[model samples]
Target: MSKNKIITVQNVTVTISSEELDDYICITDIAGVKSDQSRSADIIRNWLRNRSTLEYLSVWEQLYNPKFKVFESEHFKKQAGLLTFTPSVSEWIEQTGAVGLYVKRGRFGGTYAHKDIAFEFASAISPTFKLYLIKEFQRLKEEENSKERLEWTAKRFLSKNNYLIQTDAVKNYLIPKSNYKDNLEWLAYAKEADILNVALFGFTAKAWRDANPEMAGKSNVRDFATVNELTVLSNLETHNAQMIREGRDKKERFTILKDIAEYQLDILNEAEKIKIEEKEETEETV
Candidate 1:
């Protein structure tokens, strides 16, 4: 089930459900702010019947939803504002291939729309309510962004620390063995980094960029790695450094590093599973 959050705008509580791409706010709850809870459906229907509302919604669908049926939307647009014409959430969805609005039916059921559409609906209900809704939504996003930055910083610190360990080993062990000129010694360090990347991530740094040209503008592949992958990469860095000091061949080191990466990831995943199961059991008991 998707996690749900409640945000109060001008003393009226509205529910927002999270999904993969965007948050969906309960439009019916917003409707209740202008009318009684019993009249939410009536108010929504009346709003949907307005020609202006249909035009605005059609523009939104065209901009975001590629599969939006232009023919069907045009048909609805012409029928709008007629005395006999009335529209409902389900009827609109039936005509248009829009994932923008969802009619959830259960204990916490309501007419939910994507944040973009919901904010527009809020503006129609009351400008004051719309302002507060945007304010609360921004507050939620800022909190989430802050938390994510802190986690990324922590993992990056771990990766950098292991990098220092690896570099020190290169200076003490690999440099003397290779007997390379001062200007060419940096190549060995770059080669050592690739060894770890290939062993753990199955791609060299250059190879990753070649495959993801769009992402290359913003970051390298490691920057988008999962927490588990970062952890394994950090471990591999230290282990590769030690292996270098022991004078292991590249083929032998790659084989050992790959096995270690797999083993450590399995262990980490198992531990995470146990923690989740324990938390769920506690919640059920409570």
Candidate 2:
């Protein structure tokens, strides 16, 4: 579990955890919608004891969990649907090594099931509730994806603005100092821009276009860059401009900018990893 997000279906607030790439929905909360809060555990256990539920769980575990205990699952399958065969979430995990469901304890504590299983479990609550849950979940994911695209667009805009700063430095400081004629001065700006491109992306604009001819007219390399790459590119543009002002040669500036790009990208990647780990820990405690 990472951070917890919520969706309300028929006034029932259900918690969701985006665990890695999969979404885990709080089945305990779903149970509350079917019965009183105190009977949620019993409701879940009753569902778990159903033979059809056991068959579905066994198939899911076999498909996704290499470490799943098949023999233990078989033992449970034989007992499923019996009056004395109630199983708790923790017991199932311990015996079968299942990853489809997990019991988290704390303020937001509950049994969370992977979206596939949660949707199945929701049917046991009510077909109407299950349909609403699926609809709301899809809406939440689409909203998140849209937000991510918006952030990427904002970063791309920032990178373009910084590129203008870099070009201005070349026009004011580097071009006039060179022997280029009036009409050919544009080459100096192009060369300076390529220096940063080579340092960060290991290719010139023309080289990238030649390599991806299909995307040449529609988008450049920067348009396809990751958020971290765009961030480092933005920084490199500023640094390259300052270097040009200091009268650094193209070769020397490229070398320094490449080193900075590598170092900053490494730091940013590691920071992102740490942030995810910290979020998971915080969610577990909560």
Backbone clashes counted, model 2: 0
Off by over 4 Å in 2: 163-286
- What is candidate 1's lDDT per residue for 1-286, written digit by digit as tens? 4789888877888898986446899999999989889999888888888888888888887876767898988888898879999988888988887667889999668899899889988889998889999999888889888997898688778655654455554423321122122233333445777767766666567766666677678767676555677888878977876775455666777778878988998898799789999999999999
Per-residue lDDT value at 197 in model 2: 69
TM-score of each: 0.58, 0.59
Give candidate 1's whole-model lDDT: 0.77
Clashes of 1: 0
Q: TM-score for model 2?
A: 0.59
Give the candidate number with the greatest lDDT: 2
lDDT of 2 by residue, 1-286 (tens): 3889989999999999987436899999999987888899999999999889999999998877767899999888899878889999899999999999999999778999999999999999999999999999999999998997898688677765655555554423321122222223333456766777666766667766776677689877676565678889879987887775455666677778889998998998899889999999999999
Query: What are the lDDT scores of the predictions, listed in order?
Result: 0.77, 0.81
The worst-scoring run of ten residues by lDDT in candidate 1 lies at 173-182
